[model samples]
Target: MTNEQFIERLQQPNWSVSCKTEQQVDLVLQACRTAGISSDKREEIIKVLRLPIDIGFSKYFDTIEYAHNGAFKFLELENITSWFFDAIKKE
Candidate 1:
């Protein structure tokens, strides 16, 4: 999906469990953790990204993570900032 689409989907307050979308979310979460982004920072970034939708949404993105996914793996601010901007442009 395009970033706009992803952003729209993410803006929703709830997501029902599904086989497909779950994996993708997990992938992003896991990648962020593996990237070594702190759980706090990962959350801060996600929060910032979600500001357009519901500012409150940013506060709780992590509460909705896949069961096994604790954080994004190998998450570097530079890389993530790039991804966020790129995704926004694509949107």
Candidate 2:
């Protein structure tokens, strides 16, 4: 997909992300099940086998993203970033 398309998808509120192998995706699916979230929910399960290291934090901070949208509270850095990585994984 194009960069624009990717950026657009990232803007969506809900997404079901998956990693390679069932073992990789197990945690995410389990969380969804525990939350009682159905497969039809407004979530996207992107199956990317690998991710580039260079595609780092830079892509996440867009001046135009929430610049003049007046949606300040919704686009807080802490909130957006926490979704991208698992907190416990970093530990």
Candidate 3:
């Protein structure tokens, strides 16, 4: 699919939200599943989607662990995205 088409698919609101980072990663994963996106391709796709490339599987797992530990609050996607971007920039 073209980047625009893949992006349209991702914005369809077909998925649920529990953890912000996990849901975003899953959305990209599902979009890439049929297209056979490789690891590098996955990162590129996320960049097109305007998400931080560093917010990959490990970050999703960390989000889940944080939620499980009762250490997270629901945040807007924009907030989470900005926070991820800032966190990566700091590192």
Candidate 4:
């Protein structure tokens, strides 16, 4: 999907579309490309997303791993989109 369509999807109050991990990753990569996110930053974001979460420390860490695999399961589309925005803003 185009970046506009992707952003529109995120804007929905109850967007519940589910995708496979690979598909979700691909969509984020495509969105980054469409947004002109630099290669290094894109790779950094992808690396962060792909990192394994340590279940033992889920209660302590505020990192994406904790958010994604923690009790809250907060790695939904909106959250991922927010991460992408944050990645873009990072130096």
Among the numbered candidates, top TM-score falls to 4
Which residue segments of model 2 deviate by more than 4 Å?
1-13, 39-85, 88-91
Candidate achieving the largest lDDT: 4
Q: Worst 10-residue stretch by lDDT in candidate 2?
A: 49-58
Write one digit per residue (lDDT tens) for candidate 4, span 23-88. Answer: 555554454445443255434554455433211112233222222343344523223444444543
User: Candidate 1 residues 11-65, lDDT tens each?
Assistant: 4433322112433334444434443322765444544342212111232454433
The global Cα lDDT (0 to 1) of model 1 is 0.36
Listing every candidate in turn, what is its Cα RMSD in Å to the true structure after a full C-alpha superposition?
13.6, 13.7, 13.9, 10.4
TM-score of each: 0.26, 0.30, 0.24, 0.31
Model 4 scores a C-alpha lDDT of 0.38
Question: What are the lDDT scores of the predictions, listed in order?
Answer: 0.36, 0.33, 0.36, 0.38
Tens digits of per-residue lDDT for model 3, 1-91:
3555544433432222232464565554544343343256544444455323223222233221112222233331222344333333453
Two-way TM-score contest, 1 vs 4, winner = 4
When summed lDDT is taken over every stretch of 10 residues in candidate 4, the lowest stretch is 54-63
